[model samples]
Each structure stands twice: as C-alpha cells, then as structure tokens.
Target: MTPIKDTHPSASSAVESGAPGARVGNFRWVICGLLFFATMINYMDRQIIGVLKPQLSHELGWTDTGYANIVSAFQLAYACGYLFGGRLMDRFGVRRGLSWAAFLWSVAAVAHGLVRTVLGFSIARLGLGLAEGGNFPAAIKTVTEWFPLKERALATGVFNSASNIGAIVCPLTVPLLAAKFGWPAAFYITGALGLGWIVAWALLYDSPETHPRLSVAERAYIEEGRVVTTEAAAPWLSLLRFRAAWAYMIAGLLAGPVWWFYLFWLPDFLQKRYHLTLQQTGVRVGIVYTMAIVGSIGGGWLAAKLIGRGWSLNAARKTSLLVCAVCVTPVFFAASVENSWVTVALVGLAAAAHQGWSANLYTFVSDTMPKRAVSSVVGLGGFVSGIASMGNAQVVGYVVTKTGSYALIFAWASTMYLLSLLAIQILVPKLVDARENERRVVTDDGTSV
Candidate 1:
C-alpha cells in the first residue's frame, strides 16, 4: 500500500520544470489507434464461432449442451490465461507480451480452419481463449503508460469501443465468408488479420519516455501528476487486500456474463426468436453491436468531460455508470416484445449501455491504483469474469434446453448492471488513489521530515 517514488530523474525533472516549454505532439493518440485495431481484431476472431453456430450445429449435429461445452472450454482457458497473462505483461512489459499473445492467438484462430469435429473446435477455442486473454491486460497497461489520468477513461473508452467494432465486423464479414468460401475460411481470414497488427505494434509501440517519436512536452504532459512506480511487479494475490480490487472483481462477475451471453448467444436468439436467416441475423446483429459502439464512446466522453468541468473523478465515473445501468433496464421487455426490430432496438440499447459501463469500469483501475499494479489488477478482474462466463455458458445451454426460450436469460441480463453498480458502490465508496495516500504525511512545516 506504500507509494513508490518515481525512479527516472530526467522524467521527474522534466515534470517539475513544466517541460520547459517543449512543444506537445499527438503521438499518444497514434498509440491509442493501434490499441483500437488490436482489440477489433481480437473480438472478431472470438466472435466468428458465435456467428456460425447455427450452421455448424446443423451441419455437425451439435446439441445446445454440446455448443455450450465448446464455449465453456474457451472461457475456462481464458480464466487461466488471464491470471498468468496479467503477471506476464507486468514482468515482460506490454511490447513483448502483446506480440507473443497476438502471435499465439492468431495461430490458434487459423487452426480452427482445420478442425471439423466438436472436440477439434473446442481445442482450437481453448487455444484462442488462452492467447486472447492477454489483449486487454496489455492494452489497459499501455493506456496507463501513454495517457494522463484525466484522459484515461476516454482513451479506454475509445479503445474499448473496438470490441463493438470487432463485433460489428464479424457479422458483416463472417456470413459472407461462410456463404462464399466455407465456414472454415471465416476463421482463416480473421486469424490472419492479427499478424498485420503484430507488425504494426512492433514497429510503432514503446514506452513514452523511450519512444522515438514522442515529443518532450507530450512526455512531460503524460508524466505530470502521474504516480511513477519503481517497485517490482506486485503479486496478483496481494491485490485482493484492497477494497477497490474487490469492487472491480465483483463488477466483472456480474457484468461479464451478460456481455458473454450477448456475444455467444445473440445469433441463436435471433434465429430462434425471429426466424432470421444467416444473412439476416448478420445484419441485425451488426445493428445491435453498432449501438454499443456509440455507448462506449459516449460513456467515456461523458465522464472525461465532467472531470474536466470540475466534477470529482468519483462522481463523474459513478454517474456515467448509473446512466448505463438505467439504459440496460429496458432489455427486460425485449423477450416479451413481438416485433423483431423492436427487440433488436431494446437489446441494442442494453448492449450499448454495457459497453459504456465497461469503458468507465476499466478506467477505474488506472484512476485508483498505482501504475505498477494496473495490469495485475485488470488481470484479476478478467479472471473473475472468465469464471463467471463459463458458468453462464452452462446455464444458458440448460435454460435453452429446458424452456426453449431466451426470456429467462434476458431477464437476468437486464438487471445485472444495476446489481453490479450497487456492489461497486458498497465495496468502493470513493475512488482514492493509492499513491496519493502515501504522500499524505509530511513535516509540520511542509518540508520532508
């Protein structure tokens, strides 16, 4: 809990001197762009299976239970990978950690093209989940390193919106690829997309201080008011002591399953509820996820704007979260509505709200924790989310088999964000910076004693 001092003397001096009138540059935004694309590709790769589930089920004779098992394999592997991936990113740094993760997941994505049986697909999904787990940890850490505290939520929101973009891309392209080339081609094409990102990442990414393209003013600007940690990577288990960490974990436990349900089962829901064809499902699903893109950016922007206008960070973040939770409540009516587009609009609103909530939720880590602990804490939340997602897959499969309706699942999703918000409020009543606490005690005369 003790604050670690900034170890880089030059950076500290630069900050203290107000960067000496150095001209600011926009290089940090360039880094944010890369994160956006990486996330887009990550989700596209994962979503291909969901888009093709019906075709695969019919062609291969997969029961709902069987399909759930396949999804469960991925979630289970993701849970394991999130724990280790966060630590690895902390130990090895984002550049190398993200490169390896992209490479491994891409290979796994391509491997799906060669698999035909349920077992084969499950194995490929397991690999995909393990490798893909590193994406958010590395991306979140990069945002911490690149952006200032005030801008972190907006940056996180912008990059996080790529998830919806990826979701959008999957439906638009996956159906065409499956219809034209084969379902396997969908996997092959999306998997190859990550390699291109790897090259760009290797070429363009580095720490702000070390990055060749970064300006002195920008570096100083980013460093100002930031807690520069010089400590070794904190153990993942050690993070559990903080109430902030528990708040994040519980939020993920409640909200992660809802997102998972949308990602994996929405296509099935469309097909069952409205009797849409593959192409029709693709278009409608795209519409739903597109709304999420708007929510993600809007949510992040709202909080950032409020913070800029003199709102406390805690108030701004929590206020955005409350808005998102209210937006999600209308989805409770989605299952009862007779019109399909009406249903899409309702579900879309909920999905959008989820993204908005997620954008701020992610920013909470960098806002409250020290720089060194950001990736590890993010990894812990993801680990909890993955476990919850695994259980959700099983429950969804069971519910579908028993009742032959998505109403029960929709009801649960509708209320999760509000529930999560309450848990967050209870656990972390205020967002307190750990490093700020460490500086609280000074001499009576205000000089270091």
Candidate 2:
C-alpha cells in the first residue's frame, strides 16, 4: 500500500516552503488517547476468560484438555480475524475498520456469558478472538499516521501499555465481578466498556485534516513526516514488493504466539503449579502486568534515546528487543523454582521484558513501512501471527493436557523471544537502505510528507 498522502490545505506549502508551521496539529495525541483506551478495553475483554478459567472448568465439568480446547478456539479465531482485520483497516481506514471491529468483539464478549456448553464457549471465544484481533494492526497504523519517527516509539509505548492495564484489570476486577455477579455478568460488564469507548471514539476522532479541534500547530507537526497525498493514494503493489514488509511479518509470526500464551494461560499456570488461590493469583497477576507497563514506557524511552545519540534505528530497536528476549530466559528458571514469591518475581520480570520488546517492535513496524501501508503490513503480519498462534495454541493445549503442568510451556516461552530476535536480525539487517529510495516527500518545513 502506498502511504497516506497529505490532504490538509497546507500540504504543498508545507512541502515547498520548509516552514515551521507546515505540519501543525494536536489531533494525534488525542487519537493516541482513544487508541490507548481501546487497547485497555480490548485486553480486558480478551482476558476475562483467563481469569474465570477455574470457575468455568468447575462449572462446565471441564478437564484440562477441555479448557485448553476453548482457549485454542479463541486463539484460532483471533489469528484469522487479525489477518482479515488488518487488511480491512488498510483498505477502509482505521476509523471505520476499528468501529466495526469493536462492535463485533463487544458483541462476542457479551455472547461469551451466554454459553452453556463446551462447544458453545468455544464458538463464543472464537468470535471474541476474531473481533479483537484487529486492534494492534489498527492502533499501530494510527500511530504511524499521527507521529514523527523520533516520537513514534514513545507514542506506541504509551498506546501499548493499555494492554497491561487490561491485563491488570481482568484479574483484579473480573474475578470479583464473576464471583458477585456470575461469569456472564463479567462478560456483560467488559462488553459494556467496549461500547462506551466506541461511542466516545466515534464522537472524538477523525483524520488530522478533518479534526476541527486540532490546533494549527498540532496539525502541522503531524503532517511533517507524511509522504503521500489524499487525492493520489499509493498503490498497494508498491508496499507488497518491499522486503521490509516480509521482515515485519516474520517478526510478528514468531512473537505473537509468545504473547498470546502469556495472555491466555499464565494465571492458570500459577494456580496449577504453585497452588495459589484465585484471589491470591489475581493479586500476583496484577503485579506481573503492572511491571509490563513500566517496561513498555522505559523501553520506548531507551530506544528513542539511542536514536538521538546517533545509533541506527535498527541497532537501537533490535538491541532493546534482544535484551528483552534474553530476559525471558530467567522464566524457565523461575518455573522450576518451588517458592511462590520467587516464581512470581521471575515470571513478572519476563513479562516486563516481553512488553519492552513489544513496545519497540511496534515502533519497528512504523519505522520500516511507509505510513500508507502500516496498517496493511500490520494486517498481513497479524495474519502470519494468527497462523503461528494456532500451532502454538494446539501445542500448548496438548502439552498441558498430557503433562498436567506448565513446565514445558515456560521452556517454550523462555526461548520464544530469542527466536524472534534472531529472525529480526537475520531477515532485516539494515535500518535504512538507499536502494529502497529513502526519499521523503518533503514539505517546506523539512517534514517528510
């Protein structure tokens, strides 16, 4: 896909004059806020099932295999949804795509509460996964549109941290809600949050060119690094031919499953191995996700700092990702530990590392692709990730069922980040390539629109 071109009245003047005001606008930060809240809701809805796993198992007479099956169904559907949603967002634009995705997923979340049988739950989870899958592709694409290169990482970090909030909220709130109001009620509550966000989003967000509240300065600032025009959209074939797209997709396929595993099963792992009560597990789980928030922001800051100090964006982003990947090694050791607190600490550290890696990775996509194709590439990558996740889901489900433990799962988790690191390194060795025609469609203010 070709980059989204400048549509603002200042487009030609911004490119020709190199004036300071060419790229003015404040709408991006507001868009970022909307994305952040959406993520929070996305994650909360996704993880409610995880928090209620034990209760569901008891009530439904599910064995470990049965629970795993349901989880697998969600992942399976989610993987497919992401593949479709990403492309849809790229084709239709984020505003419409996200609105549809949110509505579908919110409906699915409520449907989750209505299921009575194993088959029913599986179907509901699949729908939820399908609907929720579009989130990252859309959000990351939005970030690329709204932010400059230097600020992209931090902006992505801020938006990505919402996942941690969702994770934290799921454990802290879902269980209590489930206990007091029943599991179905928990679904309804989370579903309602999505609807509220959808309404607010519809009312508040639009393209920078269209947003009325955007200050002249803010709009100019955002339009600075953009490279395409509204009237002459870039061809999708141009983006599809880029090697960078392949690199980003490979990275996503490798890492997506790792994150999905953590989101779907970590709480159950704590309960099964360490014998923690649901309430106790909830508190510890909250801590793990809380640490993830810290990592996301910190990792983003570090990468931006490295870029500022003359490091190549590739070097800076990959270095941070590799470090985070290595940190996951400790989790394998953590899983073998007998002490509950020590186990929590180690897993928590690993979770934080995952977030840090993810924060930079999200930025990495923005760095590699033109703004127009960001969502499209993200969609394609999400599709790859979705397929990869299916294998991971089935494997983890079968492993947990057969072994009756999370030990093997932890071992796989420990090595996943390292594998992703290698894939990123071997696949895309450079940050910028002159052969790729690194030309910025310069607006007069030195903005690359």
Candidate 3:
C-alpha cells in the first residue's frame, strides 16, 4: 500500500522536518503491515473451527445439521455485530476501535477451549463472531485514512492478504496442535497470539495525521485528488440514502454466503469428498489459502497497472472484477469432474478469483464514499452479508444433512460469484461516487473520538 501524501498546508507542514522542504517518508507501509498481521490473527482464530470440524463433530457427537447450526450461530451474531461494529469504529476511530475489537476476539478465541458440548461450542463461536465482525470495518476505514484513491485497491489487497496467511497457518498448525495437545490447547495458543497483537497495535498504530514518520510527499500524495475526507464529519445517516452504497450492499449480500460457505465448510467438504485425514485436509486448505495470497496481491497489482495506463479508476476496478467473475464461473463444472487433482485445481482457481474480486470490492467503498462513512458503509454491507451468510449456513446444513453430498454446494459456490458480479453491474453500472446530497447522513451521531 502506498502512503497518503499531505494535501492541506497543515498536513504538509506537519510532516516536513528540519529542511526547508523535506518529505516525512512513507509510513503507510508500516500501517499496512500492522493491519496484515491483525488479519492473520483474526483468520487464524476463525479457521481453527474448520480445521477441527471433524474432530469437534465426532467428539461432541454432533450431526452435520448440528455442526451447520453451530456455524450459523456464529454468522447470526456476526451479522448483528457487523451492524454496530462499523458505527463504533467510525465513532471511536480505527486505532482504539480495532484494538478493542482485537482484544475482544482474542478473548473469545481462548474461550473456545472451554466448550465441550455442541451448545457450548456454539456459544463460544458466537462470541468469536461478534468480536471478529469488527475486522473489515476497522481495516477498510484505516485504508481510506492512509491510502490514496489510486492505490486503495492494492492497499486493500495487502490488508486482506493476511487472511490467507491466517487461513494457511491455522490448518497447518491447528490440526497438528490438536493431534499433539488436544483442540482446546490449540485455541489457547492462537488466542494468545492476538494478545501480543493488541499490545503491538496500541504501541504502533496512529492515524495518518498523528503518525510520526509520514513523509510530506507521501501525505500530499494521499490528500491529492482526494474526494471525501471531510465527509467523514458528515452524519453517517447521509450515506444511507446513496444509491451507490446500496449497490455495494446488495452485491455484498448476494456474494457473502459463498465466502462463508468456504470458510466454514471447505475442510469438512474436502474430508468427506476425499476421505482425507485431518492432516491432509489441513494441507489442502492451506494450499488453497496460500494461492489466495498470491491472487489477492496479483489482483490488486493488475488493477493498479491498468489505472496507471490511463484507465479510469472505475474502469480498472470493473475490469478486474469482471475477470475474476469470469474466472470463477468454471468452478461450477468442477464438482462433476472425477480427478482429485483437477478438482483441487478448479477449487483453487475459484478461491483465488474470490480473493482477487474481494481486493477490488473492498476498494470500491473507499473510492466512492467519503472517508468518514467508509466504516459505517462497510458495516452496513457487512450486516447484510452477515444475514445472508447466517441463512445460507443453515440452508447448507440442511441440504448436506438431507443429501449426504456437497455436489450442489460446490455448484452454488462456483456460480455465486458470477451472480454477484451481475448484481453489481445492474445496481451500480458505473463507478462514480454518488452525489453529496444522496450520501448517508449520521443523525445525532456521538462518539468517543
């Protein structure tokens, strides 16, 4: 992620040190690194459930429907939290809000070890969901604060890439940890990692305006060609009225289930489909996420290169998203294939395309919304996504229980991306920011920050 350049005289002067004209040096990279690690911790805690699902289900004597309901419980709470978490981030500012969120989820991750029954596990996962639901709202808000429009997609890509890291690490580590020490101990160790991150975040993170080492040139670059920093001061309710915001919301809702399906079910699916051992399942999931990391970064770079070539920001994003949309459609046919390696390749491509599409979609908010509303808008979208995911989880659970197969599930996963892309096209059709009067307005908004 590129640093934001100073725009105003105050911002410019703040970063200039010693010399008559000196750049503060870019610090956005530092912030991006912090966010990346935080995401790693977030996904690590979340992915443990998938990696341990077989063990957990068997140990707890739970059925597929029961496991699905447990997953649904997390999504249900996450949906509710997403509604409020973004607003909290906007009110409290990213540093404090994210730090608190990280701490909460960390505690919840540890709490997972305490649950022995399905009900107990469900409750613990719900807590984990509520706490983790804050992640994207806080991360995306920081991206808006630190990166310029030109590099926002790439910045988002870097921030999100950490999730792949988390996913990869969890499977590789969790299964082994569970084998050696038991599943509960794995939770304790992963939970502890987040505690260290909370301390690091408190020590390292500050807003762009307050960061000590931001370069004058960097700050200027960020503020240059900016559309909406001051809009953050506007009531977030103002953002609700914007049609463009709804476009993102609807797109998120349609697509959210597909991701949740992968996150919560992929390990179980792989295990059942191939009769793989837990360790093998972990490796497979790890490979998929590792590929996702590449996809996320590569996707962002591809779009930036297009923008650098004089493509409009909207054109670049749309083009990249469309590519991802097209690439993912092939996954639908993958389920019917007989070869295991071919199935892996097809699933990997679909997973990669999802990450690529995600990197661009997250940037879409920063591109269109004023900085102030970014988190809230993200939260709104998350809320809708969370709801769809909750319902989707339950439905999948029932389907899997009734059919004893995931063929239909994989088919849905493959096609959902294309459907979502179409929704985005029909709803948005263009990438321009909505008119100022049409944006969401915060009414009687009050916050700690």
Residue ranges of candidate 2 with Cα displaced over 4 Å: 1-27, 230-240, 433-449
Expressed as tens digits, the lDDT of each residue in 314-359 for candidate 2 is: 7888888888888878888766888888888888888888888888
Position 105, candidate 2: lDDT:
93
Local distance difference test scores for all models? 0.88, 0.79, 0.80
Question: Which wins on lDDT, candidate 1 or candidate 3?
Answer: 1
Candidate 2 backbone clash number: 27
TM-score to true structure, per model = 0.94, 0.90, 0.92
Task: Report the C-alpha lDDT of model 3 over 1-449, residue by residue, as the tens digit.
Answer: 11234246543554444444355456788888999999999998988888888998888888887888788888888887776888888888988888888888989999989878889888988898898889998999898888877777898899898999998898899887888898899999988999999888898888766567676667765665553334334455567656667877887888778878888888888888778899888888888888888888878988999999999877898999888888877778665676656777777788788888889888888777767777888888989999899899888888888888778887777777778777777867877652232233445453221
Q: What digit string (tens of lDDT, one per residue) describes model 1 on residues 156-211?
A: 99999999999999998998888899999988888889998999999999989788
lDDT accuracy of residue 132 in candidate 3 = 89
Best by lDDT: 1
TM-score of predicted model 3? 0.92
Error of 2 at 14 (Å): 9.2
TM-score winner: 1
Q: Name the regions of candidate 1 deviating beyond 4 angstroms.
A: 1-21, 437-449
| Cα lDDT, model 3, residue 225 | 53
Query: In model 1, which range of ten residues has the least summed lDDT?
Result: 440-449
